[model samples]
Target: MAFGARARLINPRLGTYFSIFAALYTALFLLVLIFEQLKFDESFLRIAFLAGPIVIYAAIGLCVGTNDILCYFAAGRRVPAAYTGLLLGASALGGTFIVAGTGAFFFSGFDAVILLMGTLTGFVIMAIGLAPFYRKFGAFTVPSYLGRRFESRGLRVITAGIAAVPMLLVLSAELRIGGHVAQRLVGGSANNLVFLLALTIAISTAAGGKRSFTWTGVAQSIALFLAVLGVATTISVMVTSLPIPQLANGPMVRGMVRNEVNEGLQLIKVWPMAFQLPPEGFSALTKPYTQPFGSIGPLAFIIGVFAIATGVSTAPWLLPRVAATPGVYEARKSIGWATVFSGLALLTISSAAIFLRDFTLDAVMSERLGPLPQWLHNAAAHHIVTFDQAATRLGFAGLKFDRDGVLFALPLLVDLPSAFSYLLLAGAVAAALVTASATTVSLAAVLGEDVIQGMSWEPPTTQSRVWIVRGFIVVVAFCGAMLCVTAPSDPLRLVLWALSLTGASLFPVMVLSIWWKRLTVGGAIVGVISGFVAGAFAIMMGEMGTLSTPGAIAGILGLPVSFALAIGTSLMRPEVSRHTVEMVRDIRVPGGEIIYDREMQRLQLRKHSRT
Candidate 1:
């Protein structure tokens, strides 16, 4: 039995299959590169190469289809820690992280580094505060766990509604960015590209559910990691004559800062005081380019960091990945691995942004309105790279940068081979699709299992439940795609909006539910609703185009109100049931599998009995 368990964990067949697929795709990519170099107008070849991998990935997902809800929902609770970690990290590193986040570093300078730090610290909070317990509780999803813990269907339904907001918003942002990438690669309508990408995601997600996303996420992570590392390393070597960009790019950055100052381009003090913003009327003062806290002062910056950290800790899509792990120990270990992966990706992205900025400055200064590079012209055509030549004498004129364009524009900015640019775009697409699929699954799970099932008069049959979940995947994907077409906010801002909502509304109650035995259903519901209202209002005020400071401090406004209301209301109300009390104790103990194992057996028995 021990040997069989170990073999199952190792899953040699899956490993071999993945290795073969990777080699095949790599060979195909190299072939396409060669064709391009031969001057064969490889537009068709490039599209074929890019589209083929996605189809193959979807086919693999379909091949792995399962009727078991346990498998569909949580991969049968048998995935090893390493795969779980990779999937979680990949899912977390969405299109926003890959495509728009680099632009953020270009725009916000070092202030954006705070957001990255908050994300890493969030995983630490998850590993220590949430993952082990959530695994031990053995719930299929976060809302389901909340319902069981609080012994209230209303709480489950409300949590589901609240959770859906951020999931849908984030999904829209992912689709929007994915569309931009597809447009860059294929040269088509952005809306059409989004619909196609959404269709692809829906098909892949509906076919194998969480199980498919797990394996595909591993592939996506590898592609993104390699693409980022390769681009950043290559650019760093070209710029500073050093291979390690994270270290060597400092001098380049310093040189850029000196040039900007000498040219009378407004810039804040470098290092330590990088939080200061440039004066108004600077062309670079776009959305996030404004003061970090607007009028809320420095304390708002600290609040923003904690808000993002809390959001990452309690995000609906991420919680299910942690629950899929086989045991508490593996769940905790998976978060550690996830942190390492995220840290490496973050390092690469930051370095890439810095290097690109320096490269762009040098290019513009050298060329000075004498016809820019081909990549810049392409980007300008797409409205990604704009130029403001009104102040050409300042030597910083003619360059208006958008954060969303930095990653995709980097290859062109440095004049790398066309094949490398294609590879990077593919990486961005992988990141977007992987995240969209995971979010779709999580959204479907919550809406179908938690909302629909909780509101049902009778328990849904296993087959009916599976169908409902699959149906929700299509519906959610369509809605997200539509929003992608209509939503006006940039990708990074959309992501920040979703995170701020989650941090303000869900994080407070989620933490207390596990740590505070006295937390009553009334308190949980009240806190969540109040936080949601406050957070939404704050966000709306910011969106109304009148209150910058209110939006910057939106999380601060909602979080404290929710925390206080929850604690105050819980003290006024009665404590929860004894079972709930003991469950809390159960989560804190280590190396236990009886709870999850029994749950799995129960699900298996139900699946077999129904058939």
Candidate 2:
């Protein structure tokens, strides 16, 4: 009771703790920028900027390391909503959103808003429909929640195996992007850096599981916010003389539209599902910035948004973080806050893309300019932006830009202080590390607890279980890092693929299990298998170039089949028990003892009586 009281006292102070960390992190980077301006060695400064926060995050993880069962797995269920929200928001942004996602906006123009809308819409669904109820049940992993809800250990094990696919995909995406940023900083092989970054993630995750995961995630989020918003605001003030990037990009967009007309860019009305790229002699810069369906088709856009949003709503890594919150209401509130933070990060990214595009249109492609700017040359040296040898002045057909490197290249492109570029690099790495840690830890928990323990009739001791999870964290991080090095995909597409898989395979059954009490174990098992297979098939086809937009298409094919299968199967085998029906009814209520905990206690009592 005294410990609980002390925790309550500390809970409200979390915001203050994170705020101080943000201020100090910003101030340290500012000092580094000042040193760079004062003729300090660029190499040392780059190392310091990237390495400093990671060291602190590891220290924090070590300090918070725990063997207590609940705290290890769920942060003692004491984190305040605001901090939990920060954790969720930061993990959601990942390395992909701030890095490759920014590049997508720069190239795809209006078509990229589909990604933003999908993510924010997913947050809304969680806030209203999913998160609170999950909190009330208080399961450690999504598989555990489903397994217990259906009273089937086999279902839990099967779901754990299926869910690991998308979680590892997300982990690989974060590691790949993080390694890229690290390589940009230190100028070494990205494969080595990926392994190194994975070590850092393992340290942070294995130290305290979600307990350490939460605090490190908050620190990383603040770093990301400082770097991304700081760069956007500075560039906004320089370009438009306004500090707010989101509200100040209007004239820039109009400027782009006018430039597109001057360049004689014409839109091709392709079939709605056809894949389109800029025609030869045309580059992304030569296309209309405000036009829709210029790249991804209209049907693909809608499907992409739906897939991403649904995936976000049901992400195993994301939803389990809600278990750290104090109650169901706090979980809902945290999701609301997550929506705000992620939405802000995304909008700032779009605004930054606009200002960067404005730079290219006004300077790089200008007929009067004698040669490409030194910044573009520098970008090309980094292999960030490429140009055609046969390229003519004002013709974009000869230019190509790598989307994944755009965010790191933006400050240089905009001619900001080189220090700002390093700052952005640090920020991107932080985002990646935090997310990689979250996904790694989630995979470990799902496999370690939901699968290994669920398969055993006898539960392991609390210490053994914690050690088991820590061991799995290291293994999972290694696998993800190796995957990143071995078969790297575009980070943005990887993210979308993970979201599509999670949404397609898990969302329908998760929802039905909560609202439809008649859902039988056979129905759920079949539904999960069917959805996963369909989603995986579509993803493979897309990867093989059979589909224009595989991530979105996966959901379009998988969701309906899963929903139909689960419902039809349930109706066919209408044999749900009265107790399960009562449990589902209880979960929907906001205030109650955690339903999962009560059920576990009853099972324990029965076991004791039998023994």
Candidate 3:
């Protein structure tokens, strides 16, 4: 079993193989300091400058491109639709979604659990109601679908523009995250020109596309899941009986500590009826449930339902997977199970961390820390403190004064065994690679579908087209890397913004295109463009401290505006050709199987006619 696992984990490609070595080396380095007194220093210079960006980019390039690109080439022409779904799902596992969950954790605390339920609900509803139609259209790019639905060059341009801006930003965020992870691993020996690192990552990603991205995602998800599992499990065992922190420290303490603790316990208690929950406790679950349409909130439920329902087609990450395999439905059938298991696994890890976080914080505040030892950052609870400092205390060992840093600083203090430490560290690198590879390919496809082909530009040869795509990948990567090296933001924070923009903006447009037949060419074009602009507009505005509610609303209006514009305009404008309806009727085949029979049927018909 060990041998098989080793063989499976180790890749044959030079790039992947090199990354494996780096993982092992970094593990050894961490192992030496597993018991050390190193503090969590997350200053930009420490985290970003100290880490080598190019190498990290190169590593992800292997994971994302190799298998993903191979699978695409192997599919020949007219790629299967189901493979696209698989690829999309795989890509979905990257830093973006992980950070989305993290963002929810930050803003609303555990009370934000409702958001997770709502998100899942949205996906399920969309899948059952609208996925088939979106798949049927058989369009490869989001903009292509816009063209099919609206058929107006203006709409296509707008849709492309909408998709392009956020997509570029998304890529930038991934680079930032990947660079940070690389920097952390590289420790004292980071990189010079961050763009150089970005370009390196982009090149590797461009090299493989479908084949590489698929395998890389598989690698990233597996590595991350296992690493987090080990960490969460250890903490769980250590803190199973831990209680939520209460602020019995004073009158201010009573309101802040006790109420906070009590509310937290209500949200977390596995058995709800066992203990009485505060009135606020019940409301916490629905705090973010906005635009409620009456008591049971049928409208809100539909929002979740349709979001999930249409999620199947909106995420373009799945496209390469579709083109790679032979069976479409066969592949689609596998998604629910895959996502279910994966979601459960990740949730388990996340929940364990959350429980640990609350319990530990409470213990420290009340000075009830028995044998469990104060986490690294307990030093800074001082006269008055911030949650960031509280969270920082969760690390292995803290420098006397470094607890003021963000939650990401915990990584520097972990004390895993060499083997497992390397294994876990490898996972972060894997995450970067998976994302970089997927983004690189997706970026290439967009350029192909929207820029060149949209303009009636064609390469002189198949190879030339391939090279053009590769060239574009490198260029896009270069631009992203430059931003990473130069741009100033928390690496992980940067990733969150990237994913938030992409998902919030694009998801709505993709959702509308699927089932709402009234989602005319005009509608989809308007919707996608609106989603794009609204999402971007929010990100920039929020950054300037203009938005009053930091995360309470979470840009839900982006989706509504997208829907209203698409559907409203679709209804009002002269509808484009009925081609989009026809396209969706035919394009998709679910079940996610490896075999297809259409070619076989065609050959049989040809043979019979000859006879």
Candidate 4:
């Protein structure tokens, strides 16, 4: 009774401490907003506004640091539902959403909306189908869950490799995007910026692992949402002359589309019909701006949505957050909160893209009579926007705008105050940092715990395991940073690729492991391998010019392939043991010991016996 009393008391106090910490950071963020409204030197304001939040994040990580592996791996499994939900939302709203997503919307029109809807639907599926069950099962990592659920160490190793591929690829893309933001704000070579950002992510992640990420993720979510909301709302009102941009931006967008159509028609009269083209080329040759699918097409749009939604539902980086929740109820509730928050942010992002597109057409593209806007001038100076004289006759002078630069360049295009631009940049960086940190930690934890330990006869000591995770964190960070330097891809494309791969390779297995008792070890292994290969082939086809556009639907192919293989192979193989069957049954229902510390449970049992 005394031990139980002590335990209950400690958990609340820990909650209180983190609550206070979060409140302090929130207060500090408000103060920064106040400061932004005041007059200050451009460079000084930029540095201070940008550095303040990052320093606070690092400080939080340092304060949260612990040697306890459970604390490091799962934030002691005591994180509040609200915070975990916010972290998941923040992780979902990475640089791709804030930065590259805007450009995608600019180019693809309503196709991007479908993708956002798909992502939100994924969260709903997670809340209803996966999160609660995973929390009940109490696995620290995805591979660990799969390994125990299927009773196969080799499957665990294979899952780790599959998880690592997308995580690393996505991390590298995020780092490259973050580096680009930093370079624009502070001025440095892209390679150096990537290295520095990678180091910062490594330090913050290694400092306290998931504990640090949880706290920092809340702050990041707030910053990113505010940056996006503030800019979009203000710009929407400016364009539409209405109080609510969410509702009011429609007419403005329509007018802009009409203008683009008129310009395209004028071009066709002067040049050949084939020669007059939209910015996205052949796929959007007719009424590009007004079309629902634009260059992406309807099939691709539907596939992209499913691929992204499934990806979010089964993302390895996201699953651990669910496991860290305090109970099955909270785990389920948290997914709803994450979905709501992410949905709001996406709404703001899509609105901003439409508003910015209008601004680009009126202010930047049509300003052929005089000097370009200061924002466009600076963007061109940075090589973010380039002009090609050869295509000038088609009503667009090959005004090649880097999609990744859209979010960063939006403020400048609208002539917002420099302070606001810096804040936007900081938010982009925060978004990247949140996702990068989570991915890094997940990579390390899975590699160390599932791959290395699962292969060994004798497990390492707790301290050794902790060190192993830390070492993997460093190695993964370095490798991802190097990839950022040499093989940087578009942030949104890379994110979709990662998501599609995860959805194809892991989502089916995760669902089956929790709900399907017939899932055999051999079947799971074959499913993962075959799914990965098929997904990779689909992406390769898109990249190699076989497809008109990148096959966002590759997961559509891979997922069915995996499902068939798993079902077919499981039928051919022996049934899993009754013990495994019972375990699955138990996980399906709610109400179990939420805290999953095996060692602590053992000690508590001993104490009860002695009493």
Candidate 5:
């Protein structure tokens, strides 16, 4: 039994499993393509496209599931930095970043780049300041690390509860977005699809925990990249007669700028102009595609970036990937790869937006327009964009596009084969599933391991612990689905709320725990609670119209308050336990056995002796 278990832990045979999945999906794609050629019903093809990858992902998860605690919890700590990076990158971007970010870029133009910039900055902060230390500490969850570092189980439980808020918010948003994509593909009520999506995610997460999450994440990322590249490349060839969308988009942007000006379109002043408005008044047309600061003010832009970057760096869902790496150096390398992969996708999305905007301008502004263009009708059929032909003229002002649906509707707008449209939605669904699964898996680990142990003062047996986590996965996934279906906010706003709350509540306390030996339980508790309250209040006020500022930047107010309270509280209680000081010193070293593993062994030994 020992030998069999050891072999199972040592060898997941992930490459073979992925190869099988690849073959299966390729066959499915060919089948769908044949049906398209044969003029089969469009709804049938849409259902196939939406459901095929999901079934395969679930199969992969079930195949990878393991009863061994190490394999289930952390993939036996053997994943290479590159694979870990790919997984992290995919999860980090999620459905919201790919779908909503692209839509925001399509509409907001240069203003959206500010958010991307902040998200990328978060990767740098994680790589430099957080990932290595967390990996070196070797906790299974963020709350676990906090509990161990502070030497207080009560603090662990509190921190676990606090961390769940942002992660849950993110989980619901991803599910909501996923359901929306499904609804577009299959023409059904989104509420039912959301529950279905939640069940699928829970099954995958519960089956193998992070072990399933890692390989599936890699597969999902590759699929998303392919879909994005396919649409971008096709559109680029049409626009610039070149294959490289990122490079080709430059000329197209310039053309759009010149065309807009010639048509008497002026930049839309998104925020009130600081001084008098320009002679070409704001009401006439859309903003120039390349113009900056027209959609969002500089102050809000800066605040949004800062808040998002900080929150992303400390996100609880990301740290488990760090612990899954082989060592501190590997953890750092993993985050570096995450940055590269995410940056590549972001750049591709940005270029795609420019091409899309150029297409929209041509369709509306061309003199040859006789009836509403086929592209507009096609887009309208899917409810991707709204327009009133009787009330409004044929310009940007006449159409109000759905930000969530813009990327999904891109292929149809370009008159590509309807298959490409399904492919784009497939990519969006893949991203959503991977992120939702990762978030569910991480939250399960927090609640099952850290929260449970902190409350009970005694760890359950390994078998029971794995089962407990599996149960929590189902519970958490369903709760998220219910929230998304019943009371959904904009996916982008939900993401921002999650980020702001995370940056405010956890970041300051977490950073101090790593860098400051004087950080006490009282300080962490006060800082987390205070920051969380301050950020939540700001978001509420912003939403209620009580505060003039945008809700996206509300977390900024919490950062300073958190830092001051934590620092001052620690100073007032200056006594430091020797063991905690040594633990702090030990985590900073890159080369050492995992501290969490050592502590676990001690605990197990003590329990055995007591028995």
Candidate 6:
């Protein structure tokens, strides 16, 4: 009872939750404010900007969900697919989408909104692969599923390795982009030193395990939803004229073509930066969407998406939630909705960011030249800080592309005050929390179940399991943080790089293993290897602007080649078991539904069919 009383006093959720919530926003907001008000050194701002996402992400990642058996509700079976998808969509969009997607997903300038929408729409169809099929198996992660299906440690080892790489790579991109977005939101210099940000994420992630991190997701997810709503409303009010922003950024581009307005739309000019005009934005190097083509054609885009979809499907982070769901149906429902929501957000947000980043140059100029009294301007305008030292600014900080005069892009981008902006930022932060929490918990699961005890064995005591996860959280966080020191500049590219790796290694094997009865272990091995190799090759080609166009054509081709090899080998060999074939029949339904049953007699009959 004494301990219980102490626990209540010390482990307060409501207050700590809100405080973290407020701090998350305030810390990020303050960084932007310093620049608008003080005109601080850009280097410092870059360095400083890294702090919030890392810290907030870490803090949220450590929040736990009590698993008193009751905590493991039958969400998987009970929740409708649509509702599950909604939650997933909302969760996957996280902080970055809120900041980058909503802030930038406008029809006015860069036509960025359109690009993101395309990605989202494509993903909607894509999520189907994961929902029923993955849910049916009742596996938590891609690798775990591989382990279960193959019953081959060799296969599981390779798959796990393949799956983990992309996650690590993408985490770097997320951190970098968060820093970039934060830098702009703060104005000039967030003083967020890169190491500071890295350290914060490391510390926070290391704090707890699955128990602590789930709530962090809840807190962050809630914050993100609210923030997006607020920002969405604010953007609506600011541009009462352009109804197009609501329709989708791409449509506006089409309208531009229809009205011949696109022909005359001049690129916004911000000093020290050059962005693309709408007519040929992809061709423009200065624009964020500019493909790293090195000189390749449009086909690279297709290849890139296919790889991203195939390679990065079963994130390590998404597994535990799969475990927690009530049954296969619930899990399916969640994944389907998750795909759509994430896809939409990715599309809308990406397009909006491109639009904002491109057009904001002009917006900056207008804000500067417009006739409002200087004093009447927001607080950011009233004060400005400047830094002179060159070497000092560049070291700890990150890149800041000032798209124009003093009123820079960051704060304007995030100044989520009033009704909408604040809410949006909150949402962005919340999303960050969700990803962080999910990732941390998933990592814990991996370490506790896979690495420490092997797949067949699980911890006997909840207390022991919790401690194992907590210990691993610290170790993993340290390693990941160290990687962030060498983080890259272009976040989008970085994300793709990691995702492509996944496409190469794991995509084909999983698909064939689930869909085809004749697929053999040898075939699975060949497919994983060949597909991975092709994926890597494709990524290089796409990045270099070489073999692409039908978009995802590379992935389509790569997987088939890999699958063919696997099947050819399987047919050549004799280990093709009747049991495996029977297992396949049990899972793959007309609509691809899976039902779980513990009844031993029925299970024996099901097993007998395989023999």
Top candidate, metric TM-score: 2
Tell me each candidate's RMSD, in Å, in order: 4.1, 2.8, 10.1, 5.3, 4.1, 9.7
Q: Count residue pairs with overlapping backbones in model 3.
A: 71
After aligning candidate 3 to the native by TM-score, how far in Å is the CA of 560 from where it should be? Answer: 2.9
Candidate 3 residue lDDT tens string, 1-611? 74463344334363465457447545534544443334433343223322333354456546444322223333232233333433344355455344333433422343334334533453454356434434444344566555545555566555665555545655666665555445444443234434544555555556665454454454455555555555445444444432211211123222433434443322222222111111110111211111122122333333332333333335454433444433334234434544564455436434532443443344344344444343333313321112344342322122222111222322323433333433434455555556666666676767765677675422234465556666777777777666656664544334334444445566765655554545666566666667656756765665566853222222334666776787778778655556656544444444322222232245456766876
Report the candidate with higher TM-score, 1 versus 3. 1
Q: After superposition, which runs of candidate 5 have C-alpha atoms over 4 Å from their true positions?
A: 1-20, 268-285, 366-372, 388-393
Q: How accurate locally is residue 412 in candidate 3, as Cα lDDT from 0 to 100?
A: 22
If scored against the real structure, what TM-score would every candidate get? 0.89, 0.94, 0.65, 0.86, 0.93, 0.66
Model 3 C-alpha RMSD to native = 10.1
- List clashing residue pairs in candidate 4: none
In angstroms, how far off is 467's CA in candidate 1? 1.8
Is 2 or 6 the stronger prediction by TM-score?
Answer: 2
Residue-level lDDT for 371 in candidate 5: 67
The global Cα lDDT (0 to 1) of model 5 is 0.81
Best-fitting candidate, measured by lDDT?
2
- Each model's lDDT comes to 0.74, 0.83, 0.45, 0.74, 0.81, 0.46
Task: Give the per-residue lDDT of model 1 (tens digit) for 97-138.
Answer: 877667666666666666677788889999988888888877
Please identify model 6 stretches exceeding 4 Å from their true place: 1-87, 94-127, 182-212, 241-245, 248-298, 343-429, 455-466, 487-489, 537-558, 589-611
Residue 408 deviation, candidate 4, in Å?
2.6
User: Which residue segments of model 1 deviate by more than 4 Å?
Assistant: 1-7, 268-297, 364-384, 388-394, 455-459, 545-553, 594-611
lDDT of 1: 0.74
Error of 5 at 359 (Å): 1.1
Which has the higher TM-score value, candidate number 2 or candidate number 5? 2
Query: What's the lDDT for residue 386 in model 4?
Result: 67
Full candidate order by TM-score, most accurate first: 2, 5, 1, 4, 6, 3
